[model samples]
Target chain A: MSELRTAGANPPWDGLDGSDRHAACMVAARDGDRTALDVLVTELTPLVWHVARGNGLDRSTAEDVVQTVWLALLRHLDRLVEPRALVGWLVTTTRREAQRSWRTNRGQVPLSVELTEQLPTEDWLPEDEALRDDRDRRLWTAFSRLNHRCQEILRLTVLAGRAEYRAVAEALSMPRGSIGPTRGRCLSQLRELLNAEGGSR
Target chain B: MNDIDPRDDDRGHEDAAVLTDLGRLVHELDPPPVGLVERIQFAIALEHLDVEVARWERAGSFAGVRGDRPGTITFTVDNLTVMVNFTSTGERHRIDGWLVPAGQHTVEVRVADHNSTTTRADDGGRFVLSDVPAGTTQILVHLVNSQGEPGRTVVTPTIML
Candidate 1:
């Protein structure tokens, strides 16, 4: 897990911090830098994925929503005035698109189940055969036990990283000041759940 | 900095550690479908920025039965609609396309990693593009105004063949 902390230690955008790197990429992408645009797409896609999946969309629908969001971004590339707001823009757009897709899909599949109940199964990738370890399973079980809001917050904060907290807060429609505390409380709760699971085992 | 509570700092550190682990776990458990980024990059790598992007209306056949039967897909943008019926032709593919509100417009089949094929549609809005080497593909309809001059272009979302 510690090795994961160094995963992006040497980002391509030198000198700039995480959020600033995204901002710089956005500016470059808007200016028609293909490389920068690729960077932006690769970097923020995880956050977008979480947002879409968090909204209770099945895998295929989530994939379509993700594609639609990126295409929408390209259509409005020049119109995005604030490069710093890129994450928020993407998050908000993904949420809206996911909701739309969810409503559309509801026509085909009867969705009487709660959104949280659908999360674990609908969002689970079939290729996650590697998630076999006991600790990972325990962690995932604890994570699934969380209410939808906490899960959404935790996933977004983790993927978006600490630097883009403001954008994430705005996207989630929470007061900017409360994001940190809420995230802290969520992490604490997850830890408690993990401890409980471990004790019962 | 010294006035900051050490307990708060420790808590923050613990939260950071938990987040790092959680991030890794989430990514391992359910990452984006493979090559999604590449697919998007291919889709948005348009030659013209001012074109209207067409939304995929419906696909007629299952991908598994592609070569066995002619697969049809329709894309629409505003009043204009483009539908393509494609079939695997041995080593290549054949595409029969129709554009509604028929006119003699230029239709280009953009294939990734291959030279794009361009052909003009008949006044009835029917066109054919043959020998298209299959990979990822999109369609571009160059509208011609009443004066036979070029108008706004309509681009379709990328589809894998």
Candidate 2:
């Protein structure tokens, strides 16, 4: 499917090009083409890894979560309905796995910015601090501290970009119509937390 | 006091910040494990071979099929007494190898993971306890056709005697 190479030389995302190619590879993977699945894993691993770390999972836990996601996909490939929704499915699954890992571990390490450094950074561009200022970090910290229900709600809405009421309902087990108002309330609560922490920063 | 709408266009700057941080964080997140793609693909191919075998077997059409399975292949050496099992279409399922006399003779076998090699057969597939070379342990045979594609699901988990 894919050639063996060093991460420094041939990064996982070297050839994603755009979202369309990403979508194409997903379709090919579902069709049982190893070559296509190779490209799909290579291109999408970054995003899945990111989602795991972003959700407060530590490096090792996040790594396990990622591997489990791939293995789970191996066993459940035939269950995927819409090929185009592969990204959404992967994102949702990664988040769930990451959360589960962190929760099960309980008192070990918490998710922090350090989790982001587990991978090499040769391909990464510098971050703009104006964008990732103290406020952002605080929001992330608060996000990490949120109750599981709110965390899941915000995750489905703000993070993975799933706007369909039905999908959000399915993911969070809320009524289909409750998604909009619930999302608004969650964001407002997040804003309150962000604003309260602003003075100290 | 001031208020900001999370979804307003003017907050493109804030959105840009979140995206930038998220992108950087994502970029730094570890890639999938090394050799993962190959391992997964190998597994998927193996699964497909199994499905194909089950279908053929169910349809009663796998009588003489050969080289459709993916795995290491094992067989007797240099024994024309080898009986060939044929599919209804009359094809050989197991390839014949020339059984050589004792001491140390190489019996050719194919490994399903895209590798091929030979093992020493004491008296063909007869010697119950012959020691194979260190690197030439028992091979789980899955014969591929001339095109090098998996052909049949013969004996799975086959070990060279």
Candidate 3:
């Protein structure tokens, strides 16, 4: 068990950083500035995609989910109060849309297979020399083995590292207080899994 | 062995190694294929064009006849329900409708053309166009309506096409 150093309680995510971009986007979008909306969409598409995929939505469905989320954004633009909350709002909306899309379409056919089957096989190859030499395959394998929640939380918070704990907590439905502890625990779990699989060469 | 603190050992070595690897992997993972900004930008431009078209339709009439414009329109355009309180005239127009389909069309106003100034409607009846051009030009419109119907409208620009 690794000792958690409170995972940097401040997290340097203080006031508004990425959320500022979202605010700018909202203002632009509100003034009927499609360019700002385009910028917003371009920057956040990956985040939404990852969110959809992390939520167990298959690729095609996830794509639909992303599209739906954007459409919803257009509808909700006037109702939004804070510009900074866009990230959290989007993530939460995407999750809800993805789940809804999955549930709605799951009965017709399994589209998740399409996305997972289309998974980038090349990622299996460790690109970094340090990670490549000894424990690359094991680490990669362990990553795939991580449960959906862990994968999503890790990717959104640690990988993207764009949103704050409040946003992350709202998006993931975890307790606001538990975000730091859970993040630490999730990282610890990953390390443990890696170590058990002969990590660090 | 009794004095050996496992916590310190784990923190000093294992955690650092894992954190480093996690950081590397996170940065290294390729992002999924995204539509180019240019493509989105194009779509947005089309959307703006739609908004401008909408602006003309309600109270922003170009030739005293509102909602009468035509061009290679986008059928998949979204957010068309715009409520504009025109400062130019102190009037408001709430124009909400689906994208019009392709064909010869007419607009009481003009839509600016800034890109190729021409595009073909997709099978789904959406076209990418630049700003509407100037002068008494005949606008060709092939667009789909909100109900996804193939339709056409032809308009001579009274404002700025």
Most DockQ-accurate candidate: 1
A17 Cα displacement, candidate 3 (Å) = 4.2
Per-residue error at A101 for model 2, in Å? Answer: 4.2
Q: TM-score (0 to 1) for chain A, all models?
A: 0.69, 0.53, 0.70
Ranking by DockQ: 1, 3, 2
Model 3: runs farther than 4 Å from truth? A1-17, A108-131, A160-175, B1-20, B34-161
**What are the DockQ scores of the candidates, in order?**
0.32, 0.06, 0.08
- Name the runs in model 2 displaced over 4 angstroms: A1-23, A50-56, A95-143, A148-179, A199-201, B1-161
lDDT string for model 1 (A15-93, tens) is 5645677787777676766667777677677778888776665556566667667777876778878777787788878
Winner by TM-score: 1
**lDDT for each residue of candidate 3 in A45-121, tens digit (9 for 90 to 100):** 77777777666654544554565566556656777887667877888787666655544444433334334333433
Q: Can you tell me the DockQ of model 1?
A: 0.32
* Candidate 1 clashes between residue pairs 3 or more apart in a chain or in different chains: none
All candidates' lDDT scores? 0.69, 0.42, 0.47
Which of the two, 2 or 3, has more lDDT?
Answer: 3
A33 Cα displacement, candidate 1 (Å): 3.0
- After superposing all C-alphas onto the true structure, candidate 2 shows an RMSD in angstroms of 16.4
Model 1 alpha-carbon miss at residue B90, Å:
3.3
